[model samples]
Target: MSGMHAATHRRSGDPQPVPPSAGRPNARTTVTRLLCVGAHVDPAFANAVVKECIGEVADTDRFVAPSYGYDVLPVLGHALIARNRRRYRRTAILISPFVPVLLSFLGMTATIIGIALWLWATWAAVFLERLITLHTLVAHLVVPAPEGGRHGFDGRIPDHAALTQIECDRINREQDGSSGLVYYSGYRPFVGAGTWQTSSAFPILLNRANDGILPPMDDRRSPGRAEVAPFTTAEIMGYIQRRLTAVLQAEEWEGQRIEELEIARRWYRTAIGRVRPVSPKDAPLPTEQGVEHYDAAREYLCVRVGSWDQEVVASVFVNLDVRGRTLYTETHRYELRPIKAAYHEVDRLPTAISPSDVRLVAAKAVVQMAGEAIGAAVTICTFPYHLLLRALSRNRPVSPRDQNEFGAEFPARRADVLDYGARRSVREIGQAPGAHHFFQDMDVKKYGDIVQKRVSELVIDFLEERNLDTGEYRARQATILNQGIIQTGSGRIVNTGRLAVGENASA
Candidate 1:
């Protein structure tokens, strides 16, 4: 039979049971006894060890023992009275026969006080440290923007009392009795003096209603009041790392980079100037002498005009051998002229037109006169000079078919109808080569667009992936706590007779 059944039978007086072979306690009884013994022995051992350690008192120990031993008792009696004393006197020292006995009591008292103070200091330091370091680290890692940043609730007290019954019920269903308290202290404009606020109190209390003890709302000045829930270093570090990762994955930064690249590309395109062919030479000059005299002199001799009188026109020409190429061909002529002006009139012209004003003026007049005459001749001429210029400027290449039929078309001889026809045919076949293809044409926009789009998508994806709702909840808690602390500290609610009648009056 099972032990439980056997025990039940004996309890009901159904049969006389034999004694167990060994006198051993049950599991529950054994564990209970062991725990009791351990609890008693642990303190005994610790006390013995502490006594042994402080037995050898040095000079520094002598000073501290006397001062600390006396101060501890009075301070324990009344902290305000001890604080007023400030210094320990020899008369206040406690004396005893057994050195160990005296030292043990003193050491224990000192240790307790030191431990309490240290614990209080550590708790306060941790609160401030967490506030500063956590906020700083998260801000730097996340790089939150004016537009996008992590926001959350801060758990605190008065916030706990403000929750509605339904909201409390909902919180109980979600959180398994786990809650947090967050306190924030800062300057507030509405509050005459600085104050601290507590948030997340309502949710925390609701969660705690089912299980877990809610920590006491302690004064900032009290030792036991500053209790914080224990958390491992690894857990804190993990939280920081996660927050940082979320910030780095945002889309705004990626868009900014893409915008920068586009701006650079635009500036680059503007910096590159356009390309064009060099300008053409001016028109040719006309003959100055009578037409009959110039035409006859040109066939017989290589006649040339040195200069022309201002009132009379002069002419120049040259004859060339048919077999040998002439340096100055009759088809293409060159001429130079000089102008004479009165000495006093030179100042009326441009001050710095040229070093030699007379020669400069003459050359300028001759070129102007030649340009007018040539322009008139070309206008009246049957040659298609304008068409030739237009074709050259277009830079159209001659086609293979045109080359086979008409050899090559020359710009200077385009006046020949045959050449002009051949050139026109060549141009018609070739067509102007299409606009230059560039490296940027290979859908460069695709790369930048993809990067920017993916970055944006990833940012949205990341935000959706995390629990932003929780963060917002936490932020609300923080804000409520902050406001509550300010209201409480600012003395906004007055008690009867708290203020003078003349100072202020309200119904």
Candidate 2:
């Protein structure tokens, strides 16, 4: 999307439309459910958990609740989220294929209607031409010029917002027939005013019959796509760790006790600036599409540097933007807060209490409440549509695919989805004028310069002590600084554009 930038999944330069799954491909997944990624997951631990999801997962101490879903998505840890809502240690539910496919059918229906209208107009025009005799000089009054197109049938365009809202209401609505999913992740998905609503599960599946508004990214052939990076995710993670360790050693932190060193990957949305046409004969103007995401790896290192009598601890965030070939190291300053910490222990049910039995009881309870039957009837009556989708779908995936890949093929899955959603979100929900401000863009840029300057200083200082040939040292310094790139936020990474280190040349 031109408006939303997702810096999550590393891409392979292919503009393929991805089949949507909440679990896989960070670049394409919506982050509305994201509260904050828990800090406890180390890369090794996270990988182990992913492996478990791909294989046989049992109820264990860590995963108290496991559900019958495609992949083991982390929910509130109370329920199994895929098939039916059941209470475990944390209650979760697995959604059936019914809702998402229904949304697709509705989209197709709209398209068919739109096409029918156009065809009718075309035939009507021909009939009108025949009725108007060519023999008369007053033919102009009867037959209008072909340029004046017949207005489309039911001329008013469908509101993208309303359509989106209706679809969203249908898709995530609860088992109780209420309009929203039952899970309590604190954030609820909704169709904001003028926003586009979409089912991400099947990329082009729902979009096949969209009205004129959905300008598909696949059809556009957007430009300036970069080739896949040579380094794999594992390789990149390793390199970043090595660099951080070396940097820490040079800064005289060798004796410090490493309390926590965790590696996590997050993909943030990235706005692909402008997509131009392939040739003059192609699109006349640049196309703005929906959201795209880029991947960034963050390594958190917390160290206890000072000993017994007087203890000092520090944590720094190392953000690696592998695509940009830029590394950002953000150092944080802390002030101590004297507040009591609160802990929550989620109650676990007995192992003998079957999860399926619990789910049945909950449903029975809902039925007793009266409102549940209506929602169930609406869903069950649409049985034929689900059957149709199943029969037609060649790739109806039963589970979320594993995003973990090795070797040369780094980022898995298509970073591209059709730009319709992006265009819709921006038009409807752009930041209001004079809303508020935290840190401005300029503030971030300045901070990046400072970090780059410090990095340059460290490298230069190390080289100076090494007694390497001064000429070679300067040359190496340039290469070291030039490897990757810059950006903003609470942290910024800037390239030391010059080799003159001691002074604030790069800063």
Candidate 3:
């Protein structure tokens, strides 16, 4: 019965033990006990060694625990080490009566070493916990929040009521810190139980030398209410139109198209007004120009319109010249006016406008102008507008799905249309070449395959210099991880062994 019990304990692939007749337990039990004890102790010893090594290398109190949760390996190692130590002590006592003195000494020595190592490991763990907590506290206090305490709204807007005087002062202070001015404003109508009021202020405007006073108002009152008259729609429109026209007339557009001219006008009307004027005699006239010339004209118009602003506005002129008698007995020539105003008015005054707000308005105006120009070019040139539309539509920064759906009607490429010098410059230097290079070298492959592969390598290098790259980020990550690793005494020994192994493998 004893032999059978021993046999049951034996693991597969182990040698058989002496029979009960030989005065020993069956091979199975002996093997089973050896394996169980070794399995438990070996791991515990390794962990203790690692912990001691780490403690010696870094202050345990400085180590920070991971925020996610506790790591299981260290905890498991601790439990196994204690179990194995207990088992080893009991087994040693049981075998002392039968074992040789030399073997017994070796066993005792191993147990002592194990206890010492475990003590060191425990000390290291405590030290690491303390270190981590200290570091975490320091980090928390030092590291600034990414949003700068402001949240929910777009970063361009400011946090204030009525663009108040105090807010303006704060904005000025911030701008002075950066050697520039930053304007912010918000406009919202107020509605109450039985009345409405429009309140607005321009913080920067109050300090400006050119800013004027609000329009006159009467203090007429109802039976139980106060009243005020706001700036009317006609006055606002007239002011905007006059300022915009003046700005446009002062700027120059060498070979701008009708659509571009329209965009500039719209931008002036919507945003801060800016305009310049050009004589018809100075405008580019048709001189038996090819399709390339026409395309060039279109491109020039697009750029001029898109780039217009209060500080930098442009005006375009076109002159028609005919050498021979006209086919229809008269030359057909008309200046195209593509953009028309559809105004809306509110009873309340608008809030102060910021520069960023103006930029957004200008961008929208430029887009509108481009659309109108393409439409007119197609009508006059008697060519397909789909291709131009698709290309320009793709240039916009929006989702791929939206772009694809919007450009679905156009072909992938079109032939027989020669780009003029102006168009060529716009494509090669203004937009396509730089944009194509950026996508080709980007770690994230967002652009289509055609653009990625076709972009020049030189351009890719330039783009990398201009923008952040993956390689630099990877190097930084490696440095941070190395700094994060903790090293104790036994861990150092293991690490040395690992280094040797790695070097040998590499060699």
Candidate lDDT values, in order = 0.24, 0.25, 0.25
Any runs in candidate 2 off by more than 4 Å, and if so which?
1-52, 55-371, 394-454, 462-507
Better of 1 and 3 by TM-score: 3
Q: After aligning candidate 2 to the native by TM-score, how far in Å is the CA of 485 from where it should be?
A: 18
| Model 2 per-residue lDDT tens digits across residues 1-507 | 110112233222212222232223231111111100110112222233322222123211111111111011221110111111111101101122233444556698755664454333333332222222111112111122234432111111112221233332221221111111111111211111111111111001111111233444564533543222233333433454555455544544557532222222211121232331121112122222122323111232222121111111111222322232222223332211111111000011121335564455444444432332334445667868998998867554433343334423333333332211111111111112211223332322333333333444553343234322234334543554343454547587765332345652322
Q: What would you estimate as the lDDT of candidate 2?
A: 0.25
Clash statistics: count for each candidate: 20, 40, 31
Q: Which stretches of candidate 3 lie over 4 Å from their true place?
A: 1-46, 49-70, 73-505
For candidate 3, the 10 contiguous residues with the lowest summed lDDT are: 421-430
lDDT of 3 by residue, 1-507 (tens): 011122223222123323323333322232222222222324443334223212223222111111001111222222233343444433433333232333456788766665454334333333333333223222211212233421111111111122234433322232121211111111200000011111111111111112124422564433542222223322322333344344444444785322222211111000011222121222333223112421221111111221111111122211111122110000111111111111001101123335564455455544443443334334445435666887788765544543464465433333222211000000011011111222222311211111112212222232234332324323332332233234776766223211324442410
Query: Which candidate order results from sorting by TM-score in descending order?
Result: 2, 3, 1
Better of 1 and 3 by lDDT: 3
- lDDT for residue 280 in candidate 3, whole number 0-100: 20
